[model samples]
Target: MTPLLRNIVANYTSQLYVILIGLAVVPQYIKYMGIEAYGVIGFFAMLQSWMSLLDLGLSPTLGREASKLKAGVTRAGVLKLFLRFLETLFSFTALVVVALSWILGPWIASSWLKLESLSPSDVALCVVLVACIISLRLLSGIYRGGLLGMERQVVANVIAVIAATLKSLAVLPLLIWVTHSILAFFLFQLVGAIVEIVLMRIAFVKALPSVATEKFQWNLLREPLRFGVGLAFLSGVWIVISQSDKLILSHILSMQNFGEFMLATSVAWGAYSLISPLQQAVLPRLVVFFEQNQHDKFVLLYRQTTMLMAAILAGVAGTMAAYPEHVLFAWTGNLTVAARAADILRWYVSGSGFMALAGMAYVLQHARGDVRMHIRGNLLNVFILIPSTIALTLKFGAIGAAITWAVTNLFFLIFWTRIVHKKFLPEIANSWLTRDISPALLVGALLCVAAHQLNWPVSSRLLSFAGLAVLVVATTGFLLFIQAETRRIMSFFLRGIVKILCTKNV
Candidate 1:
């Protein structure tokens, strides 16, 4: 198959399988663990979010560098160099994380949280699992990054499918037997991690074209790593910003509250994960276009992508905010927790939609090799994201904390746009601001106001959801009709679909 076809299949299949498992396991987690237990689970997940730093940005850098030499370079040589750098950097970072988790897990539980319900041992068990999972994650990065750089989504997706399926399906039955303690839960996950790595290795071997090691360019390691380290710092800070809210809550609020807050945030981020398949499929291709200095083409595609992302996020976020009870109850069967978090969902999903814009902007910066600017933008987020989170958590509880998280992105988006102009394709980036972004934010705000007001007078879940559907459809239709740019993008995307179909038929 062609590379484009291959990437699409891989992204779709992998994301689909993962989503499948997520659907099965998440409800079980909610039912069995309760909101407080899920909160602990969320905290562990965030702690491992630090592993993004381990790759720095080398995975993409590896893919870009490797792609430039595709027909020209030796695969084995490229693979070897990629491994050497990734292992060294990952090992160092992973050690620090494990050490801190070992050292600090108890202190955090006893001193920071000071909850009688949670003992030092409880936090320690979570930390240990986190460290193991972090190591497995780094290894997966090496394999997946190499595959992605090689644009071997077909193989990567299979591995993702297997791992996600196992995690989502296999664990449920086992959890039934071992659901007594946190250690058993972590053990089940740790074993799943091992199974995932083994599957990923087999997939990589099968997908790769067998190239010998004769063309080893050990020297490429030096400069490529320099780029990778920059990615590490920038991506690391971003990791902290996106995932730290839960961890911060674990620190400030009780673990129980943190879990509920984290659940709401995870539900909001669903659109991001759903849309990510498209982003992953296209990203490596963007590098090739960037290498060709096709700035106009890149900007054109970005504009179209922005509109599609906005449409999907708006529709989904609107439905979610409008019928939080309907959706969350269906998904997880926990109406009490879902009801408590209804207002927070309205803002978090909208904020996540905005965050998605910032993330795409970051990806553009990555393509341009604008590392310093990327680093600067993320560093600024730490200052804004952390303080806002603490202040809001104290005053507003979970809902306030989420709004603070969202507002920080609004702040970061302003700086990110400026740097895009100064550093990347200035001309296209300039018009990009209002053209692609404004529709979603403008319409979403109007929708949120309508959703919030509808919470009353209906006095019932079923009627409230009906009101939400009306508001969402009306808002979306209004945008499609009035916004010329939104229409243009939808038209272009649909046309591409038609062209692909015609080519297949012919």
Candidate 2:
């Protein structure tokens, strides 16, 4: 199997386990927390994401550099060198997070508008929880960084699944024990982070034999900071683009509404969490293939990944779009929050699919050491996005913000595709240039639009519409993505199911 295919297998395996287990308990947690409480969870999660903003982007860069070194060198020596350097760099990043949190933690809860309904004590609790969670995450990144640096996505995925499973299983019970109690949630997070740290250390040792020694290399920091800090800034900017909305919205809108936006954003982002591990898995393979000059293999794997992601997102998007309000209620069970979430989810899906492809392109750029171009596009995006989001949201609310996000991302994708083609894939570049994927995207969007047009009963009788919505989504998505190869895969699966059914009958 190619690197992409291998990575996909690893990612899918871990994701399957995580999804089935993690998703099983998430809804219960949400129900227990209520939309507002859940929104608080979302806010802290964003802070965690933000704290990760400074990750050296050196994860993939390290993998690329190591992959090149691996071609002719001993892994043991190289791994130690790489780890020593990373340790030094992350020490600084962690210190920065600590100082920043100490300075800003108390203020975060005060300015956020959504917390008006929440007691000052509760908001204070959330902020403290977020600060601790952020600090824990910085430490966790060390192990994750090693996995990515070694192109050990399978290992990275294993760690993620374990962490997610632990997190999901813990959330509901704790919420039940202490309803919306931020201290309780903070303690749960502290415990979970410890579990993740131990698991990650174990996983890193077993999965990537690069560094098993418990050695410190503090002096190695200066070199990595010199070479890697620029990349870290680029990564931080990208995170800001993806996550700053909540902080910004908190400033512009009330924190309660921001809480609603936070919920919608969380649900919208969950779909990606399911998909990104796959992308992370595929990337190292792409880098290896490019290094090998096996362009055809790389392109084929890229194509396969794109089709599968699009198909899955289309099905997911269509289902939510069809009975958005219904699924919203069932998923979170808070109608007011659900309504807001449904709109964001529906608008966000198209962008998710669009970005998935562009994300691949960006990953490819990173693998090729072309971060400058990616940085260029991000710079353009911020200028276009911040003003638009601020202005549109002021006029049109969350839906308007979602639309701005989607449209700006489309432009960003176009810009990246142009550069990638001009620099790399001249032959297939035209497809991206002309927006050929637009047709497939249209099919998914149209299904969502059709469902909205139908305007079915969104009341207590929503299950009836839910069934119809699921059916419509499944049917449309299948027709859109059921290429010849996918059909063959389906046939094989169906045959197995049939054989089992017949054996049972006999």
Candidate 3:
């Protein structure tokens, strides 16, 4: 299989595992540890994301550099040397971040957090453990980048599946035999990180054994660092855009509400996770495409992928929005949480779905190594989002925060599309709105309406959800892929498969 197809396959396989495991585990976590501990867990999850800022964009930049090496634009020796240098830089950075988190743990537990059940000491221990886990995860990004650069996605994802299984299932044993300790919860995650690091290191070594002899040089860092600076800034801003809502909500909402909102946020962002395989698989190739001056192919790719993403997200997000209570209840078996987060989930997923669709445009920008537009867009979000979210949340609570997110993404989508057309791909400017985004919006909205009318009781949830799934697939397929050209392509593939089957039968 092609690298892109392999990467997508591997990524989807990993995500499917994570989703299934998460569905099974979330209810157990809530059942055993209570909502208060789940809040702490959510805090750790948030910090894990925030820790990406420490990467300084090296992971992505490394992928680009690795792709260049594979394409013969850079020497393997140079790439190997640079990888060692990055390891040194990342090690030092991880130490500093971990130390800082450790020092600040007490202050966060005492001042910022509002947990009623857990002691400050226990919270502190959880914080420190989470810090360690985040540090290890951040450091692991280097190896992950190395693997992806080598197009070892299948190997990388297999390791991830094993690590995730170990982490997600860790709490069950802890809750059963050991105490239902939050510290133990994070301890398991830390163990998973250790396992992931060992496996990732093996994968990297196996992919590039020449790195063993490659000397680390300070001078080798200059070029990648220069390219990485913009990316680092963009990453910092993007993190702020994505996480600022939850950070703000943590203080404003009660612990129980915050936990519920976090759950809703998790479900919403899961939409992004579903679409990420496309983005990850496409990034390395964007560089190659640009270098070869394949503008026509690039635009075609942009349109096709955007349409595909929009169709899929629309269906998923729309269904989630339309039947959030049902979906959440099914996932958690907690009617209280389902009721509390229903509207928030609806708004958050709907917005996140669109943002994920626009992420394709961001991928194109990142691949072209022109991050100024993304930086500008994210800056706009920071300036507009924080105040708007705070005001709306004060007036309307968690749902307001959800609305603020959705609105911000709407504006960003418009801004991103304008820039993409004006500065990047003007050829499709006229048709983009009508041909691309509009159809996606229509499909999503129509499906959401269709789902809303179904009103199936929770008792029949399996059949109801099954019906929803059928609606999603049928709607998305007809709108996105049932065109004349797509039909022809499908027919050709079907004929090829049939011929192979007939030959085997003979």
Of the candidates shown, which would achieve the greatest TM-score relative to the real structure? 3
lDDT of candidate 1 over 1-506, digit per residue (tens)? 44665576568667756764675577677665555666677777776675556666776666656555553433455656566556676778777777877887777556766354545687676776778788877777776766776677777787777777666677677667656455666777788788878776666556555665444465757667777778778777877777666666677766777777776777787756766776766676666677777777777666665666666566767677656666555555566877777667766776777778777776676666566776877787788777877777777777777788667777766567756665676776666667666776667766656656764542455655566567657666666646676676456556777888999999
Local accuracy by lDDT, each model = 0.68, 0.64, 0.78
The residue pairs found clashing in candidate 3 are: none
Off by over 4 Å in 3: 209-219, 451-454, 484-506
Candidate 2 lDDT tens digits, 163-253? 7766777666667765656567667777777778777667655654444544546453344444466577777877777776666665676
Worst 10 residues of 2 by lDDT: 69-78
lDDT of 3 by residue, 325-410 (tens): 88787777777788888889989998898788767667878777787777777777789988898788788888888998888887
Backbone collision tally, model 3: 0
The alpha-carbon deviation from the true structure for residue 68 of candidate 1, after best TM-score superposition, in angstroms, is 2.8
Better of 1 and 3 by TM-score: 3
The TM-score of candidate 2 is: 0.84
The total number of steric clashes, by the backbone 3 Å criterion, in model 2 comes to 3
